[model samples]
Target: MNASPVTIPARRGKAAFVAAGQSIKVINTHGEQVVDTWAFNRADITEFMSMEHTRSGSRHIIPRVGDAMLTNHRRPILTLTEDTSGGIHDTLCAACDRYRYEGLGCTEPHDNCTDNLAAGLAELGLTPPETPSPLNLFMNIPWTPDGEIAFEPPISTPGCYVVLRAEMDLVIAFSACPQDLLPINGRAGKPTEAHFVIA
Candidate 1:
């Protein structure tokens, strides 16, 4: 059973400290919302989740059930235990940032996953890396036969979720991606609630 869940508001962020053996379930309260997920060792924030390590260790661009999310030290930080989102998560893309939107022709500032991550980590008395790449949950970025990667709409629907079991004490964070400039969020760009349940 899940513990009480806390909703991470759309275009915002949230985090929690999870003990080893505990798990976190990220839920798409509304369809097509992308959640940028991150994690760090509770005892050492510098040893954070590393997508490169994960892909190298698991030998998959997109992680499958039973794959482990590796840390900078190349140790399992979390393991994918349950997935109901059709494996639409992405690893190739970096988390959106203010500059990315500006380059995309947005003259104004925007809410970004990178900033969200830092803010959330701060609440736990931790600081993230200067540039933090995350496991983009519900994002659909596929590679073509030509070896080109294309961003696409998410395959996740309302109520879809993915659960990860903590392999060690961790500070887990997530951002309900606020990128209104991409189709990854179904072109709505509008943020939606993401339920984080620790069990």
Candidate 2:
């Protein structure tokens, strides 16, 4: 892993490799950007992080520090080690894709997390077996007792971050989600760059 912080540019994505026991610190540089995150087994992309499986394993919609993020195969991939970003994250939403923007009335091609994931992995001479539901870092999705959920701006302040320890040798990806149509990024609807450091 690079010692310097790696940028996940606004409206784009980045990916990296982490060995077991290593940790990655994801920074919300500007505070409001929703980073769509994913992780895969370094030896087998098919065995990737699974939000549904993690939810079943942890029994929590929002993971807290010390919770292990599970893979589709029901094994640990990454574990939440430390968090300073208000403990607000969404594991329920799928990564934004072209069809989502299209439904939101975009007539032109839009930068999206799905594409960004592929692009990021492509940079490492790899491709995603499929787009899995991402761990939406810094995203705020409030739910009601009636089972309704609403997209809201993040509550995290600038420079707040979360650290996830790799449970296995894995590849991690992140997209500084380009969702300007909604306030998921912020009320300003401006998606900004984010950063991560592997240590």
Candidate with best lDDT: 2
Residue 112 local lDDT, model 1: 89
Residue-level lDDT of model 1, residues 104-199, one tens digit each, is 998878898988998888887778865557999999998989999888889888998999999999899999999877788897666677888999
Q: Any runs in candidate 2 off by more than 4 Å, and if so which?
A: none
Clashing residue pairs in candidate 2 are none
Task: Report the lDDT of model 1 for residue 167.
Answer: 98
| RMSD score of candidate 2 (Å) | 0.6
lDDT of 2 by residue, 78-143 (tens): 999999999999999999999999999999999999999999999999999999999999999999
Q: What would you estimate as the lDDT of candidate 2?
A: 0.96
Regions more than 4 Å wrong, model 1: none
lDDT accuracy of residue 113 in candidate 1: 90
Q: TM-score of model 1 relative to the true fold?
A: 0.96
Please tell me which predicted candidate would have the highest TM-score against the true structure.
2
TM-score of each: 0.96, 0.99
